[model samples]
Target: MSDGTGAPVLLRTDGRAAHLVLNRPRALNALNHEMVLRLGEALTVWESDPAVETVVLTGAGERGLCAGGDIRVVHADARDGDGSASAAFWRDEYRLNARIARYPKPYVAVMDGIVMGGGVGVSAHGDVRIVTERSVIAMPETGIGFVPDVGGTHLLSRAPGELGTHLALTGARIGAADALLCGLADHYIPSAALPDLLADLAALPVADAVARHARPAPGGDLAAAREWIDACYRADTVEEIVRRLLDHGDPAAKEAAETLLAKSPTAVKATLAAMRRARALGSLEAVLDQEYRSSLAGLGTHDLVEGIRAQVVDKDRAPRWSPATLAEVTDADVERYFARLGARELGLAGETGEPGAPGAAD
Candidate 1:
């Protein structure tokens, strides 16, 4: 089965298992509006089907399972002066994330390559997350002038210690080992073994198949730097965190400080606060609600526009962020990102057939 448009998403079934392949290899399988809706619909259909014991998701190409959401469309939407397109995209995308998190059956995500931003939203929430040695994961949104969304706060917050804080603020990419260390992935399988693993999944129990294929992951950089990360990123404010990093004088600390400084000040502050608040929240739904509010707030800000312009449009690599300095973004400004959206807030309830199904908000 394919969702038309040259089958941006393709589905194949074997016995009790359904395999989903993201088919836009040219785009690195970046999720677009149509792809998001199609994926959600398929997941919803399989959710209640007794014959479908498991769902396996992977990208078509070797480059990545997904790079992220189609940010170019987002840039176009932002430039078009109506936030409707971006709004619709996020509303559906987030609901998909929620559905995956609450999915009844075993949902297996093969994080094979460059998974970041919206890609993480899809894979991280699955029941069984498989990462290969080639896997590269991150939430590199801050560099693009947006705070991480799609329930990123929930996933990042749950990472051990202050590692989530460090990753969120710096948008650092982590390998399979680090991804495992951060609780984002469950099994580590060598890329060469994935074919046999999938075949086993079709014949054996999902858990048994995974256990049979899983291999020991290499050491992660995050584990060795846990103390340093915890010490620097534990500060209440981004400025204080930077100060600590710079003062620490270690090469890694200085590099981290430089990375944070290059990001949008507004986004950095907002992301730091979101990660902090997410730690206190109990559920993924609650975290998504908060993330929705922050995303909406960001749509009205200048940083997102400038950030995309610098990073994507002009490829300038230098964004003129509003409130360019950390000191200029006061506490109240950061608080505004978390403000209640009231009636306009996301409605995350319901499953496939009920009210608030995927794309209902649009």
Candidate 2:
């Protein structure tokens, strides 16, 4: 049931399976507040339905799974002097992410094409995550003056060595191989097989669906790459990450470093801090809570509106940040990013510790 706003993120149920298709192909199925609300409602219904045994999530059209959040909407809301709607939108969206992470039923994300930003949130947390040859997975949040939200910090932190920190700050796009290597995705099936696989999942029983999806090919070693990433991104500040990248001299590493330097400083700093803290937390709720605090504060402080203006609205590809350099970003600045909020704060009050939690690998 869509409101005819942006695009209808359709929810269909067949037998004991639910199929979620991101329908905004023109925009690469970018998520909006309405889509998030609809998805949450559908998930709520499916969660309690005894008839629904599994859920398969995919994007409509051939472009992608989802590009990210609807930046146009975000820009308009920011201009209206009230970012409350945007904040509330993230709160609900993060709750949805938490639910997906903890969902008991077999949840599979069919990442066929460009799966990025908010797309990562929707798909990465699934019980069985799938990727194809065409899958272009990334956490390119810093590029848009936003930290990787929607439980991305959780996934990023779990990547081998300092790769998480490198990716989080640089906003690098990884192909299917690198994505599998980083543990961002679990299974890899040929793109041509997706239709048959989807049909098989839809037709099978819960246990059978879980059994049918093929295992992922082994990802290459990231430890070798980590030495360079750690060395280049070693500085305590976002600026240092870039400087180290500049010093590395490797073409790929140099280009990646330059990319981070181009993004908003505050976003990079906030993301760095967010990923660091998320690494120490246990439950999904705890990470989401901390992220909520960071996101809420980001509405007024971070360069989201300006970033959107340059990237989406104007397409100028030039965003003028407030604190342009990482050195301009102070400890207090980063500290306030983690400050608590009243009334709408997420409840992460009593989480203790879980050693074998998802994001604690390195």
Question: How does each model score on TM-score?
Answer: 0.94, 0.90
- Colliding residue pairs in candidate 1: none
Which ranges in model 1 have alpha carbons more than 4 Å from their true place?
1-5, 349-362
Q: Candidate 1 on 1-362: residue-level lDDT in tens?
A: 23334698998888889988888888888899988999998988898888899999999876999999988888878877688888888989998898898889999999998998999999999999999989999999999878899888889899999999999999999999999999999999999999998998888889999998899998889998987899999998888999999998679999999999999999999999899877876567777777887888888788888888998789999899999989999988898998876667775632223333233431
Most accurate candidate by TM-score: 1
Q: Which pairs of residues collide in candidate 2? A: none
Say which candidate scores most in lDDT. Answer: 1
- Output the lDDT of residue 81, model 1: 61
lDDT of each: 0.87, 0.79
lDDT computed for candidate 2: 0.79
State how far residue 152 of model 2 sits from its true place (Å): 0.8
